[model samples]
Target: MVNLIRNENMKLYRRWRTWIMAALMIGAVLIGSFVDWHYDNKDAGADDWKTQITQEKQHWKEMIADPKTEEGSKNYAKDQLAIGEYRLAHDIRPESDTMWSGINGSAQLIMLITLFTVIVAGDSLAGEFSTGTIKLLLIRPASRLKILLSKYISMILFGLLLLIVLFVVSLLTNGLLYHFKQLDLPLVSVDSAGNAIELSMLGNLWKSYMLNGVSTILFVTLAFMISSAFRSSAMAIGISIFALFAGAIIMELTQPYAWSKYMLFANLDLSQYLNGRPYQDGMTMTFSILVLAAYFILFNFVSWFFFTRRDVAA
Candidate 1:
């Protein structure tokens, strides 16, 4: 099993496309940091922040008073108002213009890693069959299940590598752009009682990173399942990516319905819990994790069944 995984990893990294994806991931982070440095490097002292928050609160109040404003917009303003008030009470100036803030902001790019991982997982098995390489793989002494498992493991490891690359590149790029200050800053969040509490910086970052990583794994497994069941890599990749992006829109459109909470996308964003908010009122972190686990198991079962039972001819 060890040798099988090693061989699968070798095949994965030996491809030119693998390196290209890594390069693209690194390049995207660098470009993002450069743009942030060019546009958003203003220093905000306490008075500056107090003035800015006061202005924003006034603007939100005006928007709330307007009858023409949408409920959603008003709700967003209400949340911002609460946050602004919390900051004022806690004397927490907004996050400083520092590399740590940039690094934390760059966590939003995890979706890009999801996209690239989807492409890789979608092509992993189907591409082999399409190119008549499955026969060579099948003739090996290893069982079909082991080979399939190795491929899946390799695909996941590839995703992990991309995540590491993203973090490292963002750290380096932003560290140089904004000097390495704000390392001791705390991330503030609202509690259930509407009081602001401080969370450790590294704790919050890891929470964001791991939550996003779990989401990436779920979508990657979906693409892998499609790849195992279909012979065309293009179809698998297209359908998986479409489902990923469309899920968010669908969830938003159906949020009023109670059944929407059971949908896979509704539960995928565990980050909502970190902010003391869930997509649905009763939704909790444990519930979301359980839902995601069920979907993960289902995807893996379908992949295993199709890959091990299907006949491949070359």
Candidate 2:
């Protein structure tokens, strides 16, 4: 199994497209860091942050007090106000335009990582069949399940590698541009009870990345299932990418229905729970995790059934 996984990794990394994806991720980090540094308000004094917080608190208070505000908006404003007050009381200045801020911003690039992983997964099995390489793979001294597992594991490893590269590059680039000076900063957010809570900035960043990775795992599995079942890389890639972008829109549209809470797209974003705001009133982190686990199992089962049982004599 180890040798098979290694062989699959070699096949994956040897592709020119794979290297291009890595280069694109690195280039994006550099460009984004530079742009942020170029426009950062470096001359702002310590009091500037306090003033900004005061203004934000006033804004949130006004929003909460406005008669035209929706109930949800009022609740959101109250939460923000609570966080602002906590910051003021604790003198915990927000990490704005700092190295940690840039690193936190770089978490957005996980979407790109997901896209690349989906592309690889969409091709992993179907590409072999399309190129008449499935027969060679089957003739090897391994079970069909082992081969499929190896390919899937290799694709996951590839995605993880891209994530590591993104973090490292963002850290170095932003450190040089913004100076690694605020390493002890804390991120403040409101909990479910509308009370402020503080967490380590680095720890929060890592948690955000992992939470975002949940969606990536689901999408990659979805693409892999499509590829295995349909034997069409283009179809798999296209449908997966479409779902990645359109899922949020679909979730919003379906929000009126109670069953929408159980939809795959609705539960893909686990970060909502981190901020104490769920998609719906009853949805919780446990609910989302359970939903994702079901989908993950379903996708892998479908992929396994198709790859192992279907005739590949085309």
Candidate 3:
């Protein structure tokens, strides 16, 4: 199994497209860090954070008090207001464009990581079949399940490598740009009960990456299943990419329906719970996890059934 996984990883890295994806991910982190530093570096040394918080509090208060404000907007404003007040009372400054802050902001780039992973995963099995390499793989002494597991594990390892690259590049890029200060800064957020709390900056960043990883794993699995079942890399990649971007829009459209909570797209974003908001009123982290687990099982089952039972010549 280890040798097979290694062989699969070698095949993946031998392609020019894989290196191109890594280069692009690094370039994005550099560009984003530079842009943020250019605009916000000056404020990193500002001493009037208390004044800034006061101003932000006033803005949030105004937003909350406005009669025309939507309920959601008002609730968000109230949460921010409470958090800002907590910061002032506790003498905690809001994160500026510091190293840690830039690292945290760069978490958004995980979407790019997901896209690249989906591309690799979508092509992993389908590319083999399309190129008539499946017969060679099947003739190997390894069982069909072992071969499939190896390919899937190799793809997941590649995704994790991209994630590590993103984190390391973002850290160095932002550290150089911002001089690596405020390593002990705390992240302030409001809990479900509107109470403000402080969390470790590093811990929060770790949590963000982990939660983002759930969606990445799901999308990669979905692409892999499509590739295995359909034997078409293009279709698998296209459909997975479409779902990645359109999931939020679909969730919004289906938010009014109670059954929408059970939809795969609706539950992909486990991070919503961390923000104290579920997609719908009754949806919780546990509910989303259960839905995602069921979908995960279904996708893998289809892939296994198709790959092991279907005729390669057909």
Per-model lDDT: 0.84, 0.90, 0.89
lDDT of 2 at 146: 96
Per-residue lDDT tens digits of candidate 3, residues 32-140?
Answer: 8888878884744456888888999999999988999999899999999999899889888777756876788899999998999999999999999999988988997
Give lDDT: candidate 2, residue 101. Answer: 70
The residue pairs in collision within model 3 are none
Rank list by TM-score:
2, 3, 1
Query: By lDDT, is 1 or 2 better?
Result: 2
Best by TM-score: 2
Native-to-model Cα distance after best TM-score fit, residue 95 in candidate 2, in Å: 1.8
Residue 266 of candidate 3: its Cα lDDT?
85
Q: In model 1, what is the error at residue 283, expressed in angstroms?
A: 2.3
TM-score of 1: 0.86
